[model samples]
Target: MDASSQDVARALLGWYDVHARDLPWRARPGCAAPDPYRVWLSEVMLQQTTVAAVKSYFAEFVRRWPSVEALAAADEGEVMAAWAGLGYYARARNLLACAKEVAGRGGTFPADELELRALPGLGAYTAAAVAAIAFGQRAVVVDANVERVVSRLFAVAAPLPGARVAIRRHTDTITPSERAGDFAQAMMDLGATICTPRAPRCLLCPLSASCLARLHAEPEQFPVKAPKKARPQRAGKAFWIERDGAVWLVRRPGKGMLGGMRALPDDGWSARANGNGTPPLMGPWQPGGVVAHGFTHFGLDLHLAVYEGDDWSSLTASEGEWWPLDSIDDAGLPTLFAKAARLALAEAGEVG
Candidate 1:
């Protein structure tokens, strides 16, 4: 590393020693490295999720499955149920696959970056993070926070996706050989707290002297982004079939949107973008309400269709179970289905 880069690393590390965030998965600066299981688990859970949201879940996960072997031994269905409210069902599936792989290898995570990357569901960002934080390796770990910090530090104006290369290069320049773990965590803390995306607290930043964007008086503008394409809107309907104080629920097919989750029967949103517009049973049917939900690629307008008949013929070909209405919370439905359920309940009340 060059002299200037070395100085930047030194300043950041010095600041880190006194100001690292106290998190469940992180060891304090100057402390022994954190457990690799905690680091990997936290990183996976924190993907596209917030620290505040992850804390209770992280604690619960560790409480239940304290080690990689424990998680590996867990039933996939139980894991999926536990991960219900946390959206992005694919992550839960990948988490199980990755845990099993780690446990199969004698319940030890590999310290090498490439080896970590080869694990199931360990993407580039996650692998680098695990290597740097859990194993004290000098890997260029550029997560979203690090991306913003690096772009501003070097005043790189290239828009993201394309700008990622330059950001990685800049981050590598400042990352020190010593205390790689502390350094990585420090950048995450700094970006999250001080050099935030909106209204950065520049005066409190330790690396302000070396920050090119701060020097230019435009820190927020450095990490420029390309304009987002408008998200497509799709329409669908969910069936609310109540029989003898119980509601019909189905376990979604195990490999698509909201896969392996229990939900209200819906026109297969998983199979197609636009729904088939077919109701589960012949009416008399009443409109429960419309529940709006946003997915990664699109938004959905889900119309809830409540059955008004003692129907048995239409559902003979379908597979489902009647869950007690009072205990619906235990069903572990995804957010979209949960919303639809609430709408159905409210409509039922209005009718009564």
Candidate 2:
């Protein structure tokens, strides 16, 4: 690395020694490297999720499954239930798959980024993070935080998704050969605290002396992003089949959106091109209003269709279980379905 790059790393590391965030998954500055399990778990949980949201979940997960092997052996339903309200169901599934793979390999994670990438559900970003933080490997760990920090440091002007390549190259230049973990965490802390998306505290930043965006006095404009297209809107209906103080719940197909989780029956907007908003069985259905939900690619307006049929035999023909109405919260329903359930319950006067 060049002298200027070394100076940047040194300054950031020195600042980190006294000003690092006390995250649950992170080891203290200059301490021994954190456990690979903690690093991997925290990294996965932190993806598209905030540190505040992940703290309780991480603590609960570690409390229940103290080791990777224990998590691998956990029941799929239980895991999905535990992961409810976390927004992304796919991450929970991948977490199980990755844990099982790690457990199968004698409960040890690979130190090499390439080897970690080869494992189930371990993506490029995750592998690099695990290698750098867990194994002290001098790998380029460019998370969203690093992306923002690096983009500002070099005054990258290209819009994101396209600018990622340039950001990675700049990050590589400043990544120190030793103490890669500390450097990675320092960048993350810096971005989360001082180098915020709006009104960054550039004067307080450790690398402000070398920051190109700061020199230009326009750090906020460095990480330029392409305009986002409006998300498509979808319409669907969910069946709220209540009989004898119980609600009918079904397991979604094991491979699509909200897969393997318990939820109310619905027109397949989640896994189809278009939904007709038809009920599962022929019935004089009552409208339970609409529940609007947003996904990564689209937004949904799921209308609730309450089943009026009294014949339990006809309902039994379909594949589902009748869960107690009072204990609906215990079921691992995704946010969309959970909102639908609340609407249905309100319509039924079951909840205030």
Segments of candidate 1 deviating more than 4 angstroms = 28-32, 270-272, 313-318
Query: Which window of 10 residues has the lowest lDDT sum in candidate 1?
Result: 310-319
Worst 10 residues of 2 by lDDT: 270-279
**Scored by CA lDDT, what does every candidate get?**
0.88, 0.87
Candidate 2 C-alpha lDDT tens digits along 76-192? 889988888886778888999999999999999999999998876678788888999899899999988899999999999899989999999999999999999889988999999
- lDDT (Cα, 0-100) at 127 in candidate 1: 96
Clashes found in each candidate (C-alpha, N, C closer than 3 A):
0, 0
- For candidate 2, the lDDT comes to 0.87
| Candidate 1 lDDT, 1-352, residue by residue in tens | 9999989888988898788778988875457768999999999999989999899989989999999999999999888888888888888889999999988889999999999999877899999999998998989888999999999999998899899988998898889998887788889999999999999999999999989999986898968999898888899889899989989888888878898888888887642477887776676877779999988888999988888787566665358888899988878889898888888888779879
Distance (Å) between predicted and true CA of 85, model 1?
A: 1.6
TM-score of each: 0.94, 0.95
